[model samples]
Target: MIYDLLIVGGGVNGCAIARDAAGRGLRVLLVEQTDLAAATSSASTKLIHGGLRYLEQYEFRLVHEALAERELLLAAAPHIIRPLQFILPHEPSVRPAWLVRLGLYLYDHLARRKRIPGSRAVTLAGSAFGAPLAGAYRLGFSYYDCRVDDTRLVVLEAIDARERGAELRIGAKLVGARRDGDVWRASISGADGRIESVGARALVNASGPWVQETLTQRLDLRSTKHVRLVKGSHIVTRRLYAGDHAYLLQRPDKRIVFAIPFETDFTLIGTTDVPFSGAPGPVAIDAEETDYLLDSIRHFFRVEIGRGDVVWSYSGLRPLFDDGALKASVVTRDYAFDLARAEGAPALSVFGGKITTARRLAEHALETLAPFFPRLGPAWTAQATLPGGDLGPGGFDAFLAEVTRAKPFLPPSLARRLAGAYGTRLWRFLEQARSMDDLGEDHGCGLTEAELAFLRAEEWARSAEDVLWRRSKLGLRLDGAQQARLGRCF
Candidate 1:
């Protein structure tokens, strides 16, 4: 049987496209080389903003579209994607206060904000937001963006796709594909050294950093458009400040650094825009990148952060469209698609997209490939809720309350964590367990044997990293011994 679509990569773009296509009544198959979001998607700064910094580059359309999608995402998945307030401390040396206000105004009104509030001016002195900051930085502007559990977002899309009848094959690497008359036969190698062949009428390449390599080497297809890999690394440390609000600091180099509230106990600081040229696999934060991030944090906050203060660090490569930009930060974050058809089989390659616009990108991708499959349904993902996102009209807090009330045996913190991570789907495991002992062996950090088993059985989590880092951020809370113990379980 020939599938209507076969997607490469299991990042946000690929999973989102698969979910959309399957909902459109198409036979879809998604193949990923590793676990879902094992690369760039999971390693994001985890914000769903309109790329406020891009506005400086005059990327109005991109900002507007992203803001619109931000609203939609907040509504669709409240548990994972929620509104986050960003405080931009005034730095006269970087830009005047008025210029900052003007940018905030544009951001607020760029696309009609629904639930998110507009921007406003505020004083940092004597305020909770400024307690962690130096007295020198008193005045600043505040705006709203969003914080998301990036890995969960990717996994949710894949789960939704599978629920909608799309076949999801994780740990399957696409080795090669060639057009065979009206159908394309693709070869994929699994983790166990087994290769399998599948056929599809249309193919999609949403391999993130691997987009160009997949096109030129895997498929042996020639395309003039190439992707530039830009590495963005983040460092997680103990909570630097109080309150749920985040900070957007301006560097002397004109680049922006975000110090956001990460887990309940950590502050996430990141993102350097350095050009990279090498294999886009398992990128680690170098000493220079670490120093740069630490310096950026030290420059803004009164707290002194050093390399030793770093708890955990991660890096991801962004596959930006190579448009001759001298700086990696200036390269377009917008996505571009190259469509080629030969022997009646079509292949569409995607390049340079952020998590904010991935949903719209998938919609547009389907629209681009609509002509190839006439029976495909219309766009429907905008108003739809992702897997486990159905909290009804009561919202996340009310849902958590309901879960706790129903399962009085659950601890408040554990119940809250489970509700936020799984939302309505928490019942799949919780309904069976009566007490903490029923959870079967605490792996430390609130991760239980039951949860790990659920991840392996339901979410396709295959390794310790997949469970600890991608499935949930239990890695940050667990010690080295605990992590090794968890690893032994798998």
Candidate 2:
């Protein structure tokens, strides 16, 4: 089959493009070298904000676009994505009060917002939100954003794309491709060493960090654009503070780090912008980055935490468009597409996009290639809910109550987790089962055989890590024995 769009990566941008393309009545095929979101997509700070920091760099347009998508996505996938508030503690030593307020004001007003509340000033002296902070931090600002299961978002996009007539080939690496008359003939290698040759009318290089390498090494094409790889690392520690709200810490270096609630029991602290010159693959958090995070945390909270307190750490490379910025943090988070055609089908290479604007990036990608396929349908994903995201107007809280009421056998926590993860689609698997025994073998930390089977057969979860680490953070709760047993199933 000569696919209308053949995407080269399966990150957020890639899966999102496949979803959008398929919904537009185009024949789309998305190929991922590993499991979905095994790379950059899973490795994000996991916020759907407008990048308040970017406003300092005068990226008003990017901030506005991201903010608009923030509300749009909130309505689209209210299941996996939840509204979160970040408290920015006042640090006069870092910046004055007026400047911070102005930035916050701009952040709130940069774009049209409905579902999320705007920023507000707060007294951190005796409030629950300020209980974890040191004595000096008495004033702060609270603003709204969102948290998402980054990997599931990608998986859902792939699922939505597949349901909308797109083909997905996970664990398939794009080996190479060449132009042929009106189509692009490509060779792809599968996980079991099987090579498949396919044809596509056009191609999309959404290879995230490896965009440059994929262009040169796989397709043997030259590009004037460049990709700068920056590493962002996160650490999972025991809950640092109380309350569901997250803390946005301001650094002396004019950088920001977040301490968010993770897995209901742990705090997700991360994301240092370090220049990474190493190879592109699974990366571990650096010691300095850990120290950087630890020091930053100690500076604010009156809590005892060090490297020993660290439980789990992960790192992913951010494939930023290298515009020769001195500091890695300030690099543009905005994405760009380079559409090229040399007397053949078009190939659009994507560079530098964040999860917040992935849907918009996909829309713009199709727009960039609009001339190549004039008969493509119009954009319609803005109002469309992803697979299982439709909670039937009752919202997540209402849906969770309904799930628990219907399945009296399921523990409240397990029911809540599964409902949030799968949304309205929880019934597809749970509807037939009436009791815990029917759900299958019980793995510790709420994982069951029935859930594992659902992940493997429905979602493209091939390994234990895909279910534990990517699909959900249940890996943090599972022991080595349980992990090994789960791994054997895959």
Per-residue CA lDDT of candidate 1, range 1-490, in tens? Answer: 6788999999999999999999999999899988899999998999998999898999999999999999999988898988899999989989998888888889989898889999898888888878888757789888999999999999999999999999998988899999898888999898787988889999999999999889988888988798999999999999998899999999999999999998888999989988999987878889999999999988888997788889999999989988888989899999899998855799999988999999999999999999988888999999999878899899998999999888888778888889989989888888878788988898996788888889999899999999989999989889899999888988
Residue ranges of candidate 2 with Cα displaced over 4 Å: none
Q: Which runs of model 1 end up more than 4 angstroms from their true locations?
A: none
Clashes of 1: 0
Candidate 2: tens digits of C-alpha lDDT, residues 163-243 = 999999999999999999889999989888899899999999999999999898888788888889999999999998889
When summed lDDT is taken over every stretch of 10 residues in candidate 2, the lowest stretch is: 334-343
What are the TM-scores, per candidate, against the unseen true structure?
A: 0.98, 0.99
In candidate 2, the residue pairs with backbone N, CA or C atoms under 3 Å apart (3 or more residues apart, or in different chains) clash, namely none
